[model samples]
Target: MERPRRWLEDKLWSSFGPEQASANLRQALSKLRTALGEDADLLQTDRASIGLDEARLRVDLLEEVVPGNERIELLEGLDARDPEFEDWLRQERAQLQAMIARAGPKEIRGILITCRVDETAPGRDRMTCDVLSNQIGENISEQVRAWRQADPDMIGSTDAPQSDVMIQSQLVHEGNGHMLFIKAIHQPTARILYSKLQRIDRLEAIMQSETEIARTVFEAADQIVGKLPHVLAKDRPETRSTALSRLGLYRMFSFDQDALREAYGLMDQAFRHDENGLYLAWSSLIRLTQMMELAEADQAALMEEAVELYYRAMELDSDNGLVQAIVSKVRSTAFGDTAGVMDLARTSLERNPTSAYALKSMSEAYMGSGELQKAFDTSARACSVARSSPFKHYWDTGHCFISIACNRNDEAIIAAEAATRAAPLSRPAHRSLLALYAATGELQKAQSVAEKMAKIEPGFSLDAMVNDPAYPVRTLRNKGLLEPVRGLL
Candidate 1:
C-alpha cells in the first residue's frame, strides 16, 4: 500500500510540484488545464485528492486562479474534501490566527467589507436600512427626506447597472446610524471624466481675473513713470507739472531735480500760502538736499521733520515703540549722539527686556565706540533675557561674537558651539566658529568652517572682508585668517 501511495504521491508531486509551488500554483494549474485539454477536469480532481497536502495545494491554486465571487465559492466548499483535509485546514486556520493576532485590537469595532463593486448605475431598485436610537433615526429620516425632495431625480436615478457606488452603514455606541452612499453615473467616456475633474471653477476664475487686473495696474504705473520725463519737459510743461504737483511733496522724491523743481514751482504758484503745501515744499526741499549730498543742511531739515513726524505719530498712538525707536536711531547716527538712542533702548528694554532689536543696537553702539566689556555684558544680558524666545539663537550668536572680540576664547568656543546647535543655518554662527577655530590655532578646523561659510555665501571674498568698514581688518590680518585659504577664496 505504501508503494502504491508513494507512486500516487509521485504522480501528485509531478502535477502539484513542490511545497513552494503554493506561491504561484494557481497560474501553473490554469496553464496546465489549458495544456491538458480534455483531461483537465480529471487532473484537477486527482490534484485535489492526493491527501491534505494535495488539498492544501489545490486551495492555494484556487485562491490565485479564481478571484472575487469564484474565490469566495471555492473557500466555502473547501471543507468537503477527504478526511486528510484536516491538516490542510489546520494550516489555513493557523495562518488566519496569526493574521488576527497581528491585527491586535481595532480602534473601532465594525464590519469591514474586503471587496466591493467597482461601479454602479443610476435608477434600478435599491434599499437602505439603518439601526439607531429612535430619536436619531427619526432625525436621519427627516434629513434623508429633505435630501430626497431637493434632488429626487438624483437620489432615485442612482441605481443604474454599472453605476459607481459605495454604500457603508455604520452603527455607533451613541445609538447613531451613519450611512454613506456614494453613487455616480457610468462616465460617458474616460476623456469626459478627465475633463470634468480638470475644469476650473468660479473661485479659480475670480482669482485669475484679479491677477490680470493687478498686472494691468502695474503696467499702467510703469508707463506713466516712463512718460514723465518727456511730459514734464515739453511745451505745455506747466499744465502737466501743475496736474502732477497736486500729488503732494512725496511725489518729488520720484522725479529728477529738474523735473522736481518744475513740479515744485507749479505747486508753489498753486498753493503758496497753505501750511500743508508749505510743509510739502519744505519736505521736498529737504529730500532734494539729501539727494544732492548737502549732508549738513539735510541733517538739520531731516531732524526737524523727524521730530514733527514723531510727534504726529505719537498723537496717533503715544506708546508706538517703532516710531520712537526710529527717531532715536536717526538722532544718534545724524549727530554722533548716543543719549537719545540709549535712553529709548533702555526704556524699551525695561518694558520688554527680550526685545532683540533694541539689545542688538545697544551692543553694536557699545562695540563701535571702544567699549568691548560693555558690549560683552550687554550681549550676555540679552542672551539671558531672550532665552524664552524662538530667536534665542540670534542673541546667543551675538553674545558669542562679543565673547570672541573680548578674547574670552573658551567662553567664545562654548557659545559658538551652542549657537551652531541652536541655529545651524545662521551665517554668524558659522563665522563665529571660524573665528574661534583660528584663535585656538586649529587651522584645519578653521578651513572647514570657511568652506561651509563659502558654500552658504558663494560671493564671499577675502577682498570684501579686507574692505569691510565694519570689521577690524588689522585684527583679521594679524590673526592670518583667510590668508592660507586665499586660493580657494
Candidate 2:
C-alpha cells in the first residue's frame, strides 16, 4: 500500500519535528536510491505519496514460503537505530510469526477425504452409503487437484498428497430414507468453510441413477474450491491479494480510526493485485463501518467512496451473492436508500439462502426500513447460522444492536459480550456493552467498559459523549430502551 509522504514522516520519524522529519525522509530516500542505483525506478514517488512498484516486487514477507523457512527471521541482519523503526520491525515480525504458526507445517498437502456411515444402519443401507461416499469423495478430490494445478500460487505443489481442506461426509439412516451431510473444513481455523445436506428419499433411486446426486456433489465441489483462495490467503503469505483482503477485515473489525485507514489501504492494494469484486465490497464496508463507529468522523468523503466502491463491485460481480450482500450493507448508510437496500438484500438472500452474510445485511436493511421486529429476528437467525464461522463476530455485533433496539437488554448484553470476546479491540463492541450495562443499572460494569473503550479509542469519554452533539448520544437516546443510561452518560 502506498503511504502519503506526511504519513510516512509521522510513522517513521515520530521523534523528530515535522520540518526535521521531512528533511530526514528526503535524506533517507536519497540514501535508499543510491543503494539501489540500478533499480531506483522501483522506488516510486509522487508529490505527496511514496510507494514501491508492488507489481515488480515479490516481497518475501508477502509471498510463498519455502518448505522449511519458518524459523528464518525477517530482514535478518537489517536494523535501524530508532525506537519507531524497532517497534515497526518487531510488529511485522510478530505478525508474520503468527501467520506462519496459524498456517501449520510448511509441507505441502492435498485435501483429505473422510466418510462415515452410522454403525446401526441396516447392512444394505451401509453398503449404499459406502458406494455414495467413495464416489462423491473421488469426484471432489479430482476437482480439488485440478483447482490446485490451475492456481498460480500452488503451481509446483499440485501433486501434494493431502490438502488444507478436509472434506467429511456422514450418512445416517432416517425412517424410510437417509440424510447425507458433507462439510469442507479449513484445518487451520477448524471452521466449516462450506456445508451441504441432502436427503435421499429412496435407496433404489441411488442405484438406478446418480445424476441428481452427482450434480449436487459437483456444485458443492465448485463452491468449496471457490472458497479455498480466501481460506489459504489467511494462512499462506504467497496469496498476496487474498492475504491483504483478510488482514483488512481484521483491521476494520477493530473499529479504530487509524486501523480503518490502514484497512482501506490494504484493501486498495489487494484490489490492485486482483480485481476481485469482493475486495471492493470489503473496502466499501470498511468505510461504512468507520463512519458508523465514529459519530464525529467526516462522512462526506467516506460516503462517496463507499458508494462508488459498491457500484464498482456490482459492475464487477453483480451475480455473486456474497458481494451483493456486502455492498448492500453500505447502501442504507451511504445513500439512505432504505427500500433499495432492502431489495438488494433480498436479491442477495435469494441468490444464496445459506449465506449468513446476506442475512446480516438483510437484518440491517430491515432496521433501516423501520422493521425492528424483522431486524431482530433476522439478526438472531444470522447469528445462529454463522456459528463458529470465520466472521461470526460481524453477525454477533449486528444481533447486539438489533436486540438493544427491541428492548432485549439481556440478550443484547450477551451478544455484545460475545462480540468483544471475538474482537477485543473493537470500539463498537465495547461501546455497546457500556450502554447495555448502564441501562441495566450496572454502573460499575458500565464504567469499566467505558474505560476499555477509552483505551481502544483515545479521547473517548462519557463527558465528551454527553457534551458533543456529533457523538452517538442522540442515537442512543432515540433508541428508547436506553433511557435509563441517558442520565448515566
Candidate 3:
C-alpha cells in the first residue's frame, strides 16, 4: 500500500530532508519510469497504491537459474534513512533468499571451480579461466550446479548436495604458449575423477577474444566433459580403468613414484576385470618409468617385462596409437635403438598424429640418436599438443637434452628449469637440470639439483642416470660434466 507522501518524506529526511525528499522521490520515480519504459505495465500505481503489477513482473533470478543462491546482497549501497523502508528492503531480500535456498541447486548438483580470472596476466590470457568456465557451462552434457566461486558455507560439508564430482580448471601460460588444464575432482572423497590439459593459443585467433573466447573454449571444455560421464562411472571396471589411467598419467608426469605405482596396480586390477589394452600399455609404461625414475632393481628385467606387456597390447590392438607410442619409447630408452624408435614413432603417429605420447617418443628417439634438430622440432610439437600438460615437461627434458647437444646451453638451462617446474617428481628433469648446470660450470646449481633428486629417489647416482638409455648420446656429452659430481655423490 502506498503510505501517504508522509512515508517517503521520512525515508529520505535524514539526508535529503523533507524539503528535497518529495523532489528526490519524484525524480527517482521518473528515472525508474524511464528505465522501465518498455515494462511500465509492471509498475502498478494509483492514488492509494504503489506496487509491482504482480502478474506482469517476473523476477529472472528467482524463477530462472535454478537454486540461484549466488546473489548475496540486495539494493546494496542504497540508503533508506527511515527504519521502516530499510526493514522492507531487508525483508524482500530475505524472502528472495528463502526462495533460492528452497531451490537448493536441485536440477543442478555438483560444483565446478574455475580459476579466478587474472587481471594482471598478459595477452588474451587474462580472462582465459573465465572464458573456459563460461564455455564449460555451455557444453556441459549433464545438469550439475556450477559456480565461478563456491559459497563459503558449502565446502567440506555433507549438508550440501551429495554430488561428489567437481571440476577444477586452470589456465596457465608456460614459457611462450598458453595452456588450459582441467580436472574433475571428487569433492567428498577428495579424488580426481578426470583431468585434461589442452592448448589454448587458438584463442589468439579469435577476432575479439573477450567476446569470442568462450565459444572456442566451449568445444574444448565439452570434449572433456563429454567423456566425464563415462570416465567417472563407478560401476564399470573399464570406466574406472579410464579414470585410474588418467590419475596414473598425472602422477607419472608429476614424478610421483609411489602414486604412479599405485595407479599401475589399480590399472592391473581394472585390466584383469576387463581386458583393456589401454591399461596394459599404461601398466607397461609405468613399469618402464619406475626403471628410469625410481631405480628399478633390474633395468633389463623391467625392460623385458615392459616389452612383454607391449606385445600383449599389440596383440589386443595393433592399431592402438598410444600403445604403439609407449612401445616406441621403451625401444628408444632401453636399447638406444634410434631406427626402431623412428619407425615405430612414424607408424604410431600415422595412427594418431595428435598423440603426445607418440610425439614424445619421437622426440626422445631424435635426442638419443644424432638428430638434435629434429628432436627439438618433435619436442616442440609435443609441447604444442598440450603445453600445460605434465607430459610437456616430460618431453621438455628431452628437448633440453637436444638443446644442449645443439650447443644451445643457455636455452637448454631454460628448458631444463621449465621441465623441473612442470614435473618436480621427475627424476629425469632434475637430472637434466643438474647436467645442464654442470655443463654450464654452475656446480652450485648442479649440487642443489643432485640433493633434490636424492631426496626423491634416495642414493640417486649419476651412473644410474648417465648410463641409462634415456639420453645415450647426450650421456657421453654430459659425462665430463657429471664425473666430478660422481665423487660428491
The candidate scoring highest on TM-score is 2
Q: Model 1, range 1-489, lDDT digits (tens) per residue?
A: 012333343433444455644434446556877996865653433444322234323332232111112123324455534334545556766665554343232222111111122123211101211111111112211111101111223346464333111122221122232222221121222111100111122222212322222222222222222223232222222212323343333333322334345444544432322212223433344343343322333556655654454445445433433334434444454545666567765654443332344565576567656688888887776566445444457567667766766777677778778777766655556765776676577878877877776665445555565455443233334445435434334
What digit string (tens of lDDT, one per residue) describes model 3 on residues 124-207? 565555545444443342112233444234354445444434544566767666676766555556666556676656655332
Point out the higher-scoring one by lDDT: 2 or 3: 2
For model 2, how does the per-residue alpha-carbon lDDT over 110-168 read when each residue is reduced to its tens digit?
34554444456678876666555554454444323222222222245545454455555
TM-score to native of every candidate shown = 0.32, 0.60, 0.51
Q: 36, model 2: CA deviation in Å?
A: 32
Candidate 3 error regions (>4 Å): 1-232, 254-257, 334-337, 461-479, 484-489
The 10-residue segment with the lowest total lDDT in model 1: 190-199
Q: Clashing residue pairs in candidate 2, if any?
A: 63-238, 64-238, 109-162, 110-162, 110-163, 111-163
- Model 2 clash count equals 6
Candidate scoring better on lDDT of 1 and 3: 3
Question: Comparing candidate 1 with candidate 3, which one achieves the higher TM-score?
Answer: 3
Off by over 4 Å in 2: 1-170, 174-238, 295-297, 480-489
For model 2, give the 10-residue run with minimal summed lDDT: 145-154
- lDDT (C-alpha) at residue 21 in model 3: 72
Residue 407 local lDDT, model 2 = 78
The segments of candidate 1 whose C-alpha lies over 4 angstroms from its true place after superposition are 1-336, 353-361, 364-371, 462-489
